[model samples]
Target: MIVVLSAVLLFGANIAQAEEPLYVSVGQTTGNLYGLYTTSNEMWAVATQRCKDLGWKNLVFIKSADVTSEVYDLMYEAVGTAYYWSPIIGMNDLDNEGRWLWNDGTPVSGYTNWGPSQPDNHRKEDCAALEWPFNTWNDIDCGREQPFICFQEPSEYKRSQIDDRLFSIRKFDVEKGTQEMARSGCKKDGFRLAVVDSDAVIAKIEKSINWNSKVGYWVDGTHNCLNADNCEGSTSYVCEDVFPLVLSNSREDYTVGNTIEIECAGSGVSTVNVKWQRQDGVPTDNIWNEPLQKIEPGKATLIIKSATLEDSAKYKCSAANDIFSPSRGYVTSINITVHPEAIKDAMSP
Candidate 1:
């Protein structure tokens, strides 16, 4: 009767509703159409309207499991070739400007987004991936090991586990100086040199030691310019920090009459000294003997009275101060070439 018919209809409707697949709403469209994708873990949905507006043509799912069969094939197909290594898309690569492009040589415009400073070319790493919330792309190195996302065909009962953890370093302002000077600056800030590896730390320390002055001594946390062992345990003020030094407006080749000016500075120290030396000249005993004008607190100017090809050799600048316990120094060598014309001109004058 009527009661029996009502029960049948109600049960049928319940079964129909249960059979309908659940789709995740990524965004939405104006109409009933929902942009959807199914993966082993999650069903994602995007509004049709938003998809159309953003020009997003497809749903990219980062498959967490068995990516080898699904996304890997897509990557190979997209590149029109097979790769020896499994391709992963994620943060580091995205920061480095690595991207996935269609085999037809057109950019896949709407698929990628990236975080700031992402894909920095750290040691030439390149690859790109999409991260969540921001939905941005990060460029990374292919050889680097990291997690990845994968997409799969539609099916019901899919769910996504989003990783909300963000691994990042706090941004801070760095005082500008040479590598040595910068290290001292860091120490002043309660930090040591920002080297990631032991080898780099050793190399930096050794370089600082080798460039120390002959008469200078190392202070606690300061660089001992003189390669003296007696002061290994004794603390004294000396130049040993790694700071960057640059020489401007100096010619590679020098001759009689070529005027050379040298300047140096660092984050912590002020006042730099410039000296000129001849490698193999008449005064072999007086190699470091040239008396030069000292610029107060950071710079010195040295002018070669007359240009001569023999004036070419190594020029040294020793920069030091008492700002940090251990001071710092940097050395740069330039090959000087004196043109014959300048030599002849000097001879005539």
Candidate 2:
């Protein structure tokens, strides 16, 4: 019953086929693949389905200024030097007019580049597009056929469920192996040993397993009942996977006497928690001591009012979600140097 329920909730129904669309690789950033669907021009719904047919969860969702730049470049090159209308992507306001949301149902906030007088939602225009040449976003009718961009992050192992799948579960058995093998085995199959975050997942497993058996199972779970073990030997393990956490637009060099700002954006399964800390300095783990820090759904920004000689140190940004293991959080760092002398050498214009 759970399998049947999950199947219905997780995967999409098969749709009619269309001419193969050309997928041009835009570029890989932080292990994620991005590309444009050049050939076929389809309606908003069709474009969404086209990407799903190819196992890409959605059309590209721009989260930060850096990602926005990358998307603009991809579109510009895809359509040659000429100006085009726009690329049909996942952004839309269909659910609630005037409130644009990504395909994943997250609201658009923090960063946006809309054309002048754009997203006027003209004539019931519900879908969103990235306009070429202008390099801005515009609202368009959902029925208008336009080419779109697709995004994907290939998993390292065999997958029973893709990124689009919701609350799906699977298990694997090693018969006789160490916890490392169990984890590695899951990875080889494109999964991580299950970290039971909910009762629903474990309940499903209980019904299927011989609870009285002598064989031990491995799970990075939270329940006290699942006592921590040496993990030296386990015969069975549960496997689960999500979009791997990736960081972008990080690691820039800065000088002293100038105000400094660094941002770290993240992409992964769900709500990604981002943090910044000094990696090589007196206030190492105490990031709260920083002047200002801003946080959004999947991004974080660290600001320094003015750089000083003492501020010349390495600062690190870390991002993780509920799904990530302790060691698997995405991390990036920046190095700052307080060069007041360089600032003093500046000539007045």
Report lDDT per candidate. Answer: 0.33, 0.57
Clashes of 1: 73
Query: Where in model 1 is the C-alpha error above 4 Å?
Result: 1-242, 254-257, 262-268, 271-285, 322-327, 342-349
For all predicted structures, in order, the TM-scores are: 0.26, 0.41
lDDT of 2 by residue, 86-125 (tens): 7887789988899999999999998988888988978999
As a whole number from 0 to 100, the lDDT of residue 221 in candidate 1 is: 31
> The CA-based lDDT of model 2 is what?
0.57
TM-score of 1: 0.26
Model 2, residue 92: what's the lDDT?
92
Residue 324 error for model 2, in Å?
36
